[model samples]
Target: MGRRAIVLLVALILAGLAAWAVWNFLDGVRSEAEAEQVQVTVYRAAEPIAEGAEGGILLSGQELIVESTEEQVDLPDDAITTQEELNSVLTGRVAAGPISANAILTRSQWTEVTIDVTPLAELIPSGKQAITIGMDNIGGVNGFVEAGDRVNLIVTLDIAADVIPADFPTLPDQETGGEGATGEAETITVTYTRYVLQGLPVLAVGRNVRLDEDAPTVIDVEPDPTTDPGIEGEPTEEETGNETVFTLEVTPEEAERLAFAFENGSMWMTLVPEDFVEVETSGVIIDTLFGGNLLDDIFQN
Candidate 1:
């Protein structure tokens, strides 16, 4: 009886020890599996998203269940993940995508492109700046007259007047004296009796106006050229002077007009300010010939 009882008791003790060992091993395995299942975050567009969304857009995050594909997985509705949160789950590493939502979405074609105000410097104009309009002293160039540079604006008007020469110059008073008076004068006087279509003061003149240099320039925006200056009238050997940079302070509406003028007319810029108000606008095709003194002959004669 003693031997049988002792053997049975020993067997029972060994059985209990073995069961405990199995339980401990199982517990460790479960713990390690749980730990291996890392919590990761991934971003999902608020709307259904396609791959290649355009760069720089907002995105929302969703939490995900991830592990070695061995343990029980749980992806709950409330799982929280950010670009950083889901990097490991989505891209196989933590912090893979940009930290910001916009940056992460920038590469995606689906993302909308955003244009910042900083890049549109040329299309906009500054306030309270003086811009040159009409025939400019800058050799007839208009837009180059920047916001601060002193510029004289010359406008042409059609007025019937008595042409007088300096020798028999129509004195300001005498030119208006009689009708049908025809004389060659350096100065011509428009009679008040004449009906002027546009009126007497054809030019609105401004001097020494300050330019808002910070104003955006709207002209032909070309990359810096590597060539030397080309000869006038001959057109450049390679790249001719195609674009004219007109720097001026003008209202948005006026800017439209200036742009139109640059496209249509022969414009020039002159550094010198002239007081030749009585100059004739007609017969002065001097601008077309590209700097010839032909008009000088007409004036001299």
Candidate 2:
């Protein structure tokens, strides 16, 4: 019980205090690690959900499977965290697009199903009439053109001199000295291509029609396998040989021009962007094509 004894006791007390502090620090670290590893229940698709499928179908058909994932996982902010949340969000909603199996269900993946069925005629503007044109894949922008796209039409016509009426006044042939020109002129065919229409709004593409501009186009449901057994497999867009049809909204005068082009000339559609600018284009014939300085400009660049 002297000075040395007192100093030894003080040292032991300090050592015990340091041990307690170290133990507490380690315990807090362990708790934090456990908290970070905590799991939360989430909903995932058990099978493929077709676009436009209702949210109620997920619960009734048991298409959603509950999965326990760490809260720290990269889940979407609107991720369905509980069965109650899923039911609340999906009651009358439909999938925005095709949801693959095991995809985490999120609020952004579904949207309110539009109940009002808009008629096709109602979609066209008052001043516009819908005109449909059919073409091969190559001429139809390789079948990549959609209903809401804007397109420009280029028409190629091969005009033969014989097709002109006999009574039509004719320029005297300089080579034939104007005498032989009185009879039917020698048959000559000239091919020319011109941009006939620009910035035409496409109303529909093939069988897929856009009823509402804001809403997603309703996709046709797949034929039930039980009813038709002849279908081998769904053909990709590239594999199908069917002709692509584009329905455009145009004025009555424009429709007549389009009909003339469709009947007597080959037409090709060029896809244009929403902010497309119409530029003045001179019709192209063989003489103008070869006479232009386009080759010089290309090489100079």
Candidate 3:
């Protein structure tokens, strides 16, 4: 009786222990699976995102702690604002400055450098030439042209006005002197005049032009082609003109018009004051349009 009882009690106790062990293992696994993951909530505006926008998303960058003040950014109407959208915005690269207000972020936003390809114009076959703020061989300084000035280009055709001499008849030398010979007659040919037409305003000032020997003469500069450079940061304005000698800052659309005008007609940089109102349509034709001509045209028109 004692041996049977003792063996039965030992077996029961071992079985109970085994069940408890199994229960504990299962409980541990469930707890691990339910554990919280490292996460942060990034704030994003409520707007759709562009396919390849200038900015969005913030990874490891200048951290901006959440404050009482509401963070803001400028966003287009169709910008995106969602975790998945944010991921896509940042897929190519992240830019500095507030992600567009319409952009969405998983956690927070980071700003990287931004790059903009603006439109500009340069002389063809001339390479890049610095825009000098001076005058030429005229009464006006640099033709009175400045960095932010505008003017019409008029070309003078002839150095001097055309003139013609008339022929004369010789009177009877026999009546006056008898043996004397008659005088001969002579005449001169007339000369003609012409002028070059003026082109529309196509050029804009891109920063003040300065003298630089390292830069090449501006032979050709149109508008920036790439809508999005896909780079994370924007180069400084000076950097944009690294290879450019004359960098004319203008709108993309305006760039097209300027390029067309430059190619179609004769374009000379004429300098006019900001408050200038008089516009000359007809005047003396010259290689460059001067202030005198502009004033004359305004009155004539």
Quantify all predictions' global Cα lDDT against the true fold.
0.37, 0.78, 0.40
Off-target runs (Cα >4 Å) in candidate 3 are: 1-150, 159-162, 165-267, 277-301
Ranking by TM-score: 2, 3, 1
Candidate 3: what lDDT? 0.40
Indicate the TM-score of model 1. 0.26
Task: Write out the backbone clash pairs for model 2.
Answer: none
Per-residue lDDT tens digits for candidate 2, residues 78-136, read 88888788888888777788888888889999888654566778889998999999888
Per residue, candidate 1 scores C-alpha lDDT tens digits across 206-296 of: 3322323464653322211211122224544224322233335455565465455455444444433334233333333333343466567
List the RMSD of every prediction in angstroms: 15.6, 14.9, 16.7
Ranking by lDDT: 2, 3, 1
Candidate 3 C-alpha lDDT tens digits along 1-301: 6999999999999999999999999999978765633223344433333333334333222332121222233333333444466556555453323344434443233333344333233221133222221113242223233333444443323233333323334444765764433344444332222223222232333344432334555432222212234334676543543221223434455455555544544344444555656554544333224535555677799
Which one wins by TM-score: 2 or 3?
2
Choose 1 or 2, whichever is better by lDDT: 2
What overall lDDT, based on C-alpha atoms, would model 2 receive against the true structure? 0.78
- Write down the TM-score for model 2: 0.49
Q: Pick the candidate with the highest TM-score.
A: 2
lDDT of 2 at 29: 100
